[model samples]
Target chain A: DAGVTQSPTHLIKTRGQQVTLRCSPKSGHDTVSWYQQALGQGPQFIFQYYEEEERQRGNFPDRFSGHQFPNYSSELNVNALLLGDSALYLCASSLVAVSGNTIYFGEGSWLTVV
Target chain B: AQSVAQPEDQVNVAEGNPLTVKCTYSVSGNPYLFWYVQYPNRGLQFLLKYITGDNLVKGSYGFEAEFNKSQTSFHLKKPSALVSDSALYFCAVRESLEDFQKLVFGTGTRLLVSP
Candidate 1:
């Protein structure tokens, strides 16, 4: 019963570059969501993916995008990265059901935009 | 728009003393409230959530929260604090009527339990 897992636990990228963060949802989970946690602040929602389609998105710019595979794994891509993009990217997974479900999160990938 | 508010930036309490972290929210419809704890350099860990029934919800790590509909508040509480309980606590809200649940988080409150 492994929980949500994220890849590239820590990475660095230069300005104007691109980065992709990967996430594997918890066992028996289907929906995947991404969040950005800046220094000294709580996480802000980026977007959510279900059935291989983006269902809802936050106020992020077009530079931020995501993909969900059939296996419920997800990838978050950020293009033209800026220094402000440097933060902890968290991946959360939950079940899409009528009732409220707990969203489990991964340790997150630390992105350092240089 | 739905939003969450954690008024205190930081809270300190002596070990073995009771502790409380306050939270308030605003949403057009019914809200699904949640509390999460984050350690340094770690991701958010789910503590508890208030969905429908039971205004008082008990969660992991000896934490509990009481939902007050009239005040739109859900304050996290613990009967006795521990040094290890020190961490950043966040309050989040999601509207029940929303088709896709996306949590709106507060600015977060740092809790320090001193010996």
Candidate 2:
């Protein structure tokens, strides 16, 4: 049973540049959600994707976007990144069940903006 | 809207002593509460959750949480602490029937267990 997996574990980008982080949902899971965790803060919801479509989104601006593939893999893209965008991007996965849908997370990708 | 609060920034305890991390929550309807632990440079690991059922919910690594409805609190507890248990703990909640996709998390509480 593989867990959620994220790529580009660490990366650095300049301000106004764009970055994309990828994630593979846990085996047997279909829903994927993205979160941003800043220094000394909890993870903030970015958005959730199901059935290759965004089902819900957070308070993020247009600069933040994401896409989910038919295979349940996901990509989180940030355009015109700001220094404040430097944070850990976490991808979580779970089955859309009637109840008790426990979300599992990946190690997360660390994004550093300069 | 659903929200969670972890009042303590950090909690220190002896390796063999019991430990407790406090959490409170608010939601328009019944809440689905969760507890996760995160080590440095790692993602959050699910510990336990209270969707419905008995108030005491047990999770992995000998962790458990007691959900109190009247108080709107769900505090994580363990019988005896281990040095390896030192890490950041987060409390999260989502309305049971509302925006089920969004989970609101607390700022987090750091637990330090000394040997």
* Weakest ten-residue segment in model 2 chain A by summed lDDT: A94-103
Which structure among the candidates has the greatest DockQ?
2
Stretches > 4 Å off in candidate 2? none
Candidate 1: segments with Cα more than 4 A from true spot: B97-99
TM-score of every candidate's chain A = 0.98, 0.98
Candidate 2 interface RMSD value: 1.2
Alpha carbon deviation, residue A71, candidate 1 (Å): 0.4
TM-score of each: 0.98, 0.98
Q: Give the docking tier of candidate 1.
A: medium
- Model 2 chain B poorest 10 in a row by lDDT: B94-103
TM-score of chain B of each: 0.97, 0.96
lDDT of 2 by residue, A1-114 (tens): 889999999999999999999999999998999999999999999999999999999999999999999999999999999999999999999888646788899999999999
Looking at model 1, residue B94 earns an lDDT score of: 89
